[model samples]
Target: MYIKLLYSAIALVACTSARPQQLSLSLLPPAQQVFVQPAQQNNAIEPSINAINKPTNPIVVAAFQREALLPPHMQNSFYKNPKIAETLAQNSWFGPGEQHAVNRETEKIPREKIFIILKNAGLLPTP
Candidate 1:
């Protein structure tokens, strides 16, 4: 009972006698004058409504054209078996129309992994 009363008294004193510390407002050197940005100013910004001309895109071609391979002997040797060539072409990467597959593979790479790649590639400074 005495301990309880002592604790209660101490708590009451702590609560009642406690005063907020006064903050010392020491005057310092005046801050530099601010330059307000023009962009932040409330002004009527008219949107650009100019007619956009359709850009002429270059025609995309096959990965390997008939005449692309140089040296006739090498070309002939490579093209000896048409069936084998066709099968290999079907399974080969960097072939024509493989952009969709590349894009799918690209999506599989996590964004976090790109940071590590950039660090390894010396593109981004290590944090």
Candidate 2:
């Protein structure tokens, strides 16, 4: 009986410990490890001040302004509906003039530029 119990215990332990084998290595081809030359490293280490100093491209700035200002849902909605896009495109400011009258009265800034201004002011997130 004791031998049978021992054998059962051992079998139980073995069964519990058994696990499926896994692949040891990735299927992808081995990556080539390139050694960077010292001269290349030195050149790359210093960024060009002139490159950083360059003025922002107007088109890129406008695109970024558009990206950073509009919410993802609004952006999606605008893209989905031509009428919405037309309305948005036609308006200089968001919403009817009545809702944003205070903003209009307080800041002489045009409604079209308000989104950008609000984004710059940290009131809104990038779309």
Candidate 3:
């Protein structure tokens, strides 16, 4: 009985292992194949460093349009009144007392004093 059970287990394992391995090669559809060709070669054609430096994407330009990442006061005004978007853009630094207002709101040390903190936190560019 023991020998029979051992032979059956071995046979089961052997039978399972003997099956042909599945080769999962997913062929892209004709449209996808054509679309992917250009994208695949996109990085291969290197542009001049100057060309690479320029922001070609409109989305990126639009994102940074406000400048200084919108500061906190501008964000409040923007949510309260959409018209403030235009107003904020005209100002050099988003809003009146924005620097001081933000400084007062946060408990964190002032940016000037937090140079080491910013560097250690990976927020500021390292020298």
Per-candidate Cα lDDT values, in order, are 0.33, 0.35, 0.33
lDDT of 2 by residue, 1-127 (tens): 5655554454334333322111111211113223232233221223222132544333333333444445555444444476774565456334545332212222332322433333344444554
Off by over 4 Å in 2: 1-51, 72-127
Runs with alpha carbons beyond 4 Å of true place in candidate 3: 1-103
Candidate 3's displacement at residue 50, Å, is: 46
Better of 2 and 3 by TM-score: 2
Q: Say which prediction, candidate 1 or candidate 3, comes out ahead on TM-score.
A: 1
TM-score, structure 3 vs. true: 0.16
Q: Model 3 over residues 79-119: C-alpha lDDT tens digits?
A: 24536644643453335554322122222323233333333
Where does the lowest 10-residue lDDT sum fall in candidate 2? 20-29
Q: Which digits, one per residue and each the tens of the lDDT, describe model 1 over residues 1-127?
A: 5655554454334333222111112211113223232232222222222112322111111112222334455444554476875676457434556432212333333333433343344444554
What would you estimate as the lDDT of candidate 3? 0.33
In candidate 3, position 96 carries an lDDT of 50
TM-score per candidate, chains pooled: 0.20, 0.17, 0.16
For residue 30, give model 1's deviation from the true position in Å.
48
The model with the greater lDDT, 1 or 3, is 1
